[model samples]
Target: MNPAVTPHQQIRATHDAETVRVYQAFSDEIADAALARGTFVSPPFKMERMTWIKPSFLWMMYRAGWGLKDEGQRRILAIDITREGFDWALTNSCPSHPGEAMGKEDWAKVKDASPVRIQWDPERDLFLQPMGYRTIQIGLGKDAVRRYVSQWIRRISEVTPLAHEIHNLVRQGRLLEAKEKLPVERPLS
Candidate 1:
């Protein structure tokens, strides 16, 4: 936790020198195809549509219901992508909605031209409750998706089991144990 970071919005993620890990919940078909190819493919994983990726593990678990949300979101994937690509998305992104900084007309024009969209959602705790701070959700459009699939991804892993394990711990009131299982996420510089 950096002292300079405000409690409202921050980008915290599991990352190393070259790559940052993002979470996405997908169907079995998409997961299988992506895992097999080590990247997303067209047939199962649509390229023309927007894909949202989350850096917060607990927030992902909350959204996907610990990998038991639905068949469409049954498989939880931990994707390690190049920091360069992640930074590119951030640099070219527009806010998902209009903010005080911009009017709707100007925002609409910017969003239409940008390939990435950003949204800040409430972060989650070990028990999957919304925290005071917010985490980022990056939505990739066609152009950004092209870069992500062709040049960004380094590793793809299935973490559905880990999700269930942590969920079980939390359900049993083992806060420390569950917290220990979480990925070490630090504020991205």
Candidate 2:
């Protein structure tokens, strides 16, 4: 929403996932019915590999070009998953990049620890400009992905219209209005 040119740190919006929320981009072939039905399966969606979920809305939009670009990123879905499952992933997560202060020895251990990876990216405003705070993108691989598809997700919902609406608002210079309509997000659970 251009954030009224507000200070970036003050506007670091993040989703509050009490029940574990995730954002995924998919091709229309795989996403259409799955989004409508809130489920996933093979064929349309490859169920054999790892999957990543971005917890940030704008970030997902940025990665998928608001579903306007990319061969298999024409649709976007917001998924609600079990908190238990989400926590399991967190427990198994390893920092994609180790802390700067880590000892070389500790770094080596963390490097080999878990399949799930946690990363943070500069948060973005409605206009997709970088903000002061960071947002999360977690990668799930190997057994983690299998569990995610089979047990974690509680429901999935299509947020294409909302995404487009926000995108247009930003493109048209109506930042405040776009911010008003944005889904409330903050870190929780």
Candidate 3:
């Protein structure tokens, strides 16, 4: 069952009329190389493989251990892309588990047919505790993976500094200021 999600833990999509922002974590080998080359060049990334993106800063930190640990999670990227493209994926996405969005038949099709799956994990706080809300983690596979790398991404910038900044804030018990500096996100339509 999904955890209870509340507003305090949600990181809404920032898209207004045109674009939305998404975050991805990569290993230094991938992130460092991409930053130096000005694009994704290392490992070729097997566009056919599944890639995940998160919109919540704390959730990502929980997933990445705040960049202190986790192989290939040392670098984080904030990417700006067309809202249309993101909406397309959300519309096509299947819930990772059987829930309101899917019944038996829908889940069957999702297993092999859908390119994306959405999982809502419990929201995390600065210290990585489960918060009252939840965050979105979307998995991109199949054709969706290809489209994401070749078409969807517009701008990619490193946000490792911000990740560390927040981490430090939390460590120093400056939760309020850290929360204020976080990215403003809205729920997807």
Candidate 4:
């Protein structure tokens, strides 16, 4: 197991040498279509809109409410995509917020041009409480989205069942069991 990181922002995910896992929550129609085709399609999954992908499972649970959030976010999907594609997005990304180093106009121009947006939000624990550190959330758009759909995606699996199971365990105060049920997430090397 990798040592716990102390950095405020990091990319901790379930990953192998070739691929990394990301999570997305979708409605039944979108999830069904994507699952059936092995990739997202147009009718339900709009390509024009920016899509955010999260690597932290607990953060995802918080956002999706363990698959009970709403119809629009009822299905949780674990998507494994090529490390190359993931790296590409990071290399070409602009920060979602303007940094002190850059002026607003400059940041806006860069953000408008970049195909990916990177934001670091507070991480979550087993009970979905915010942690001290932050998790990376990648927002894909335009070319990045095209590449993600066509060249990046390796596999997609529904994990709403696992989400519910972990949630139940947490609710029952079985913190250890719930923590064990979480996917092994390590900082991406």
Candidate 5:
């Protein structure tokens, strides 16, 4: 079993003791699996009074889950694994969002370059690069895609109810309705 599989789906797993225990168990399971698969373990995490763990990163890792990328450039192909899927990479690594590698100026360029499209380039065996953008390829397939989409569906399910309610309110588009819900203001001294 992939430790990347969420504890929520692990039916046998429980989190009654400590949040860290659940995270630790999950991380250990994933680390073992990653080692077995010969994937590169990320740089050791640094945190105060913490041993190789940080809550925010754990949350990000949880969100990313587990993924695989079959083909890519030297750096990307060296490992067939990722903590998340293609779209996650596209959106998160596209320079539009903050990530490990991309800086803000680069991200601004990508955002402004929006609707940047890609066409499969046989020579590259990957998506063609968008002009004025530095990223070349991004995607996942087979088991990785299926799992990532499944995780996406589950996450969307969890958030959709409240989102739908908000959408309905926005569709109504009434100032008075929004005004009623607005926080009361207090004068500052």
Candidate 6:
């Protein structure tokens, strides 16, 4: 069952039509940048504009790449980025507490599984949906939250332009400008 999500939460979760388009446009721009930077690679799936991506989704992605030691002091697992298998990985054993730091292998495994999606690429007049789950995991402890915040900053840095645009919109009090730009008539499916 779907729990009641707060308005703020809803805003964070759901992306309106225009927002989806914006993200797609940004993704294409990123792809182009990646190509220019020699980071471009062919991917499967058709990308589409996203209506919204939930915070939980972002949390899940972050958790997958996070390096946490288990009780046995083994290797930390990572979330597999492939379209197959479980979405997370572990290094050693799960940690008893959040104080210990994760090692390189643990971070790589999870970072490799980071989920990135492209909603609608207006440049191509096409939609793309790249696979790989991007999410952050919220833990029960205060320390865990702190770590999550730190991790969140790093992840957001991956999409600097989009992040900056969002921040600017909020700072300029223009986030609601979309309401006026979109047509009032219901869109046809």
How does each model score on TM-score?
0.96, 0.82, 0.84, 0.96, 0.20, 0.24
Best by lDDT: 1
Which model is ahead, 4 or 5, in terms of TM-score?
A: 4
lDDT (10s digit) by residue, model 3, range 1-189: 133444543446556677788887888788876667555653745566778878777778888887777777888888777777787788788777787767888788776778888888877766899866677888887788767766777778898899899889988999999988787766755
What's model 1's lDDT at 181? 95
Q: Each candidate's lDDT (Cα)?
A: 0.94, 0.76, 0.76, 0.93, 0.27, 0.25
* Candidate rank order under TM-score: 4, 1, 3, 2, 6, 5
lDDT of 3: 0.76
Flag the better candidate by lDDT, 5 or 6.
5
lDDT winner between candidates 3 and 5: 3
RMSD of each: 1.7, 3.8, 3.6, 1.6, 19.9, 17.3
Which residue pairs in candidate 3 have backbone atoms (N, alpha carbon, C) closer than 3 angstroms, thus clashing?
6-133, 12-185, 12-186, 13-186, 27-72
| Model 6 ranges off by over 4 Å | 1-80, 83-135, 138-158, 177-189
lDDT of 4 by residue, 66-142 (tens): 99989999999999999999999999999999999999999999999999999998898888888888999999988
The whole-model C-alpha lDDT of candidate 4 against the native structure comes to 0.93
lDDT string for model 2 (1-189, tens) is 344553333322333444666788998888976766667867677766668888778888888888888868878898887778777887898877768898777976975778788877877767677776667778887778878878887889888889989888888999889988777775453
Our tally of clashes for model 3 stands at 5
Better model by lDDT, 1 or 2? 1
Candidates ranked by lDDT, best first?
Answer: 1, 4, 2, 3, 5, 6
> Where does candidate 1 stray beyond 4 Å?
1-6
Q: Model 5, range 8-57, lDDT digits (tens) per residue?
A: 21111111221111112123333444345443233321111121111121
